[model samples]
Structures are given as C-alpha cells and as structure tokens.
Target: MPTFNQAYWEERYKNDQAQWDTGTVTPPIKEYIDQLSDKTKRILVPGAGNGHEFEYLVTQDFKNAVMLDIAKEPLANVAKRLPELDAARLIHADFFEHNATYDLIIEQTFFCALSPELRDAYMTKAHSLLAPGGKIAGLLFDFPLTEQGPPFGGSREEYIALFGNLFKITMLHRAYNSIKPRAERELFFIFEKK
Candidate 1:
C-alpha cells in the first residue's frame, strides 16, 4: 500500500494534485451546521484541506473551532483566507498525534485518505478525543473499496459495523445535497459517542 503519511500528503499539496478538495464547504455539512443551536461547543476539523468547513463555522459565529492538517500549505491557505481567526487554532500536525478534545469532531476526506489498516486506530483515537456524547458528522464515500485511492470507498453496512459499538448511529444514508460529481457516491452520517 502507498504511504498516506505527512510526506505523501505534503507532496500532493506541493504538486497541486488535491482533486478531492471541493473548493467550498460541502452542502450536507452546511445543512447540518444550519440546524445546530450551540455556538460554544468545541469543534474540530481534522485533515481540513483548504479549510472551507472551518471557515464556514467561524463565519457563522461558532466561537470554538479548530482546523488541523499534516500539510502546512492548506493551513497557510486557510490563514490567508481567514485572517480574523486566531492563529493558535490552526494546527499543523498529524491527526493521530493530536492531543486535544472536542465536543464535535468533523470528518471529511480524512478517513479514506489513510491506509485501511489504520481504520481501527482512527476509530479509537476519535473516541478518545471526544467528550461524552460528542459527535462526528460528515460524508463518507459509498462505492467499491479498491487499492487505487486516497478517496477509498466503502458501503453503509461497513460503516455501521465499524462504528456501531462505540457510537449511536443517528444518521447514515445517501446524501441528498452532495455536489454534482459526488451526488450519489457519498453518505452523510452522524454518530454520537456512546
């Protein structure tokens, strides 16, 4: 398997090959944010390439939001784009090594970007990082899983099996608001820590 580590990602950024970036906050996540009533809950967006989600959160008056990535380029781009947000909240680090807790941990393309062997580690770390009843909400691809991608795909059943023991699966179905190319290839899910 190809390494999906910092060097691998950083090279992708350096070479401008990040095709996974949608260039804006994804619609389903935006819809999810629109229904949230609390602005004080801590939120984390790991592997936040280009940081559109965190930018949307900050602009919508969410007081505590963090954007993290192993690659510095995207974080630098985010800083330039969101000059008003505190620099301390833009973390450049590995998600596995990150040590902060949050009330909500947002996922985007980060999970699929890792080697499949690390899925359990990702699950365990996500559980550890969240406070009691904390949630993880976002899109996961719903296609065949093959060895050919950072955008690795899986099915709803796999996701349910992966997370059901540690979380309450509040929502997991096809996303109605995905952008054009991703329209039928993703699942919008919310799993609250149990």
Candidate 2:
C-alpha cells in the first residue's frame, strides 16, 4: 500500500486523481441533512475533499460547519469554491491532531481512505472529537476489506465490532439511497457517542 498520507493525497489532488470525489454530495447524506431540524449544531466534516457537504450545510443555514483535510489542495479548493465561508473553518491538519469537539461529525469517504491499520485510531479520534451526545453519521463501504485500495472496503460485522464498544449503534444497514456506482455497496450508519 502507498503511504495514504498527506503527500500521497496532495499528489492525488495535484494530479486530479481524486476519483472518490463525487462532484456533489451523495444522496443518502443529503437526505440525512434534510431532516436535521437544528441548524445551529456544531458540525465537522473531516477529510472533506472538495467540501460539497460543507457547501450544502452552508446553503441550509448551518452556522457552525467546519471542513477539515490533511492535505492543503482540497481545502484550498473548498476555499476557492466557497470564498464567502469563514477561512478559519477550513482546517488543514491531521484529523487525529484536530482538537475541537462537535455535536455532529459527518463521515463520507473519509474513513475508508485511511490505511486499515489506522481503524482503531480513527475510532478513538472520532470519539474524542464529539461533544456529549454527539454523533458520527454517514456511509461506510460495505464490500470486502482488501489490500488494494485507498477506497478500502469493510463489512457491517467489522464496523460493529470496531465501533460498538465506544458508540451506540443507532443505525447500520444497507444504504437505500446510495448513488448508482455505490448502490447496495455502502452502509448508512449513525453511531452516537456513548
């Protein structure tokens, strides 16, 4: 496997090789956001490449939306795309190093992009980032875990085993609204901090 680090992602963005980026927010996530009644919730989207979700949140009148990425390129792209958003909200730092807490964290392609070895760390970091009663909600790939991807795949059983101890598994099931390419191959989940 390649490093899957800052440099690797930066290079991917520079070369326009970010195949994981869907030019718009995924349908499941959009539907999830559409039901949110609290527009004031402190929300964070880590590894938010291109920040389509961030843009959507802003459009929906969410006040405390934050977008974080390890690489500068994507964050810069977000800044360019949404120049009116506060610059401070576009964070360029390692996700584990980020210190603030949030009421809701949005996870899309972020988790699967990490090396499988970092799974535990990702869970731990996410747990620490949430305020009391906070939740991490989004899609996780539902395919096999293999040695061949930044878009690494995982199963529902594996997710339950990994996240069950630290979070309340509010929902974990096959996503009914995943985009065509990911149809039936992703799990829509809502894991609330315990």
Candidate 3:
C-alpha cells in the first residue's frame, strides 16, 4: 500500500486527481445545515478538499466555521475564491495533529481517505475536539472494505460498532439526497459525543 502522507495528498492535488471532489456541498450536508437554527455554532471541516461544505456553512451565515486540509492546494484554491474567510481558519496540517474544540465537526470524504489503521485515532481526535454534547455529522461511504482505495469503504454495521463507544448514534442511515453517483453508497450520520 502507498503511504498516504502529506506528499501523496499534495501530489494528488498538484496532478488534479481529486475525483472525490463534488465541486459543491453534497445535498445531505446542505439540507442538514439548512435546518440548523444556530448560525453561530463553531464548526470544523477537516480534510476539506476545496472546502465546498465549509463554504456552504459560511453562506448560510455560520460565523465560526473553519476548514482544515492536509494539502496546501485545495486550501489555497479556497482562499483564492473566498477571500472573506479568515486566513487562520484555513488550516494546513495533519488532522491528527490539530488541536482545538468545536460545536460541530463535518465529515465529508475525509474518513475514507485515511489509512484504515487510523480509524480509531480519527474517532478519538473527533471526540476530543468536540465540546460537551457537540456532534460530528456528515457522510460516510458504505461499501465493501478492501486494500484498493484512498476512498476506502466500510459497512453500516462496522460504523455502528466502531463509533458507538464514544458517540451516541443519533442517526445512521443511507442518505436519501446523495448525488446520483453516490446514491446508495453513502450513509448520513449524526454522532453526538457521549
């Protein structure tokens, strides 16, 4: 397996191989934000390639939203397009190494991009980053797990067992509004930290 280090990701952006980017926020995440009454919640969007979801958050008047990416390219692209975003909010660092607290954390395509062994650490970091009763919500790929992916996959049963220890699975089901290409392959989840 190739080491999915910073260089690998930077190369993916530099070479324009980011097939996972949908160019806009997915419908489920958009709908989730649309219903949220709090425009001031502190939000973090980790591994935010091109930052479309975070962009959507800002457009909805969410004041404290931020997006972090391990690679510079996507963050730079976001910066170029959205100059209103605070420079400090567009972080370029390893996700595990990030240290902060938030009311909500967004999971776009980040989880599946990680090395499978880091799943436990991802959960721990996410939990640590959340304030009391805060939530981590968004899409998770639902498919067979195999060695052939940066967009690696996992089943719903596995997600429940993996996240149940530290988070209450408030909602975990197939996203009804997933883009056509991702239709039955994604699960929309709301996992509140316990």
RMSD of candidate 2 to the true fold? 0.7
Clashes of each: 0, 0, 0
lDDT of 2 by residue, 1-194 (tens): 68888999999999999998999999999999999999999999999988999889988999999999999999999888887888999999999899998999999999999999999999999999999999999999999999889899999999999999999999999999889999989999999999
Model 2 is weakest, by summed lDDT over 10 consecutive residues, at: 77-86
Candidate 3's residue-wise lDDT over 57-91, tens digit each? 97888989999998999999999988877898899
Q: What TM-score quantifies how close candidate 2 is to the native fold? A: 0.98
- TM-score, per-candidate, Cα-based: 0.98, 0.98, 0.98
What lDDT score is found at residue 94 in candidate 1?
Answer: 92
Pull out the clashing pairs in model 2.
none
Tens-place lDDT per residue, model 1, 57-157, is 99999989999999999999999998877899999999999998899988988888777778888988999899999999998999988788888888999
Scored against the true structure, residue 122 in model 2 reaches a CA lDDT of 98
Give the runs in model 1 whose Cα sits over 4 Å from its true position: none
Ten-residue stretch with the least lDDT total in model 3: 80-89
Off by over 4 Å in 3: none
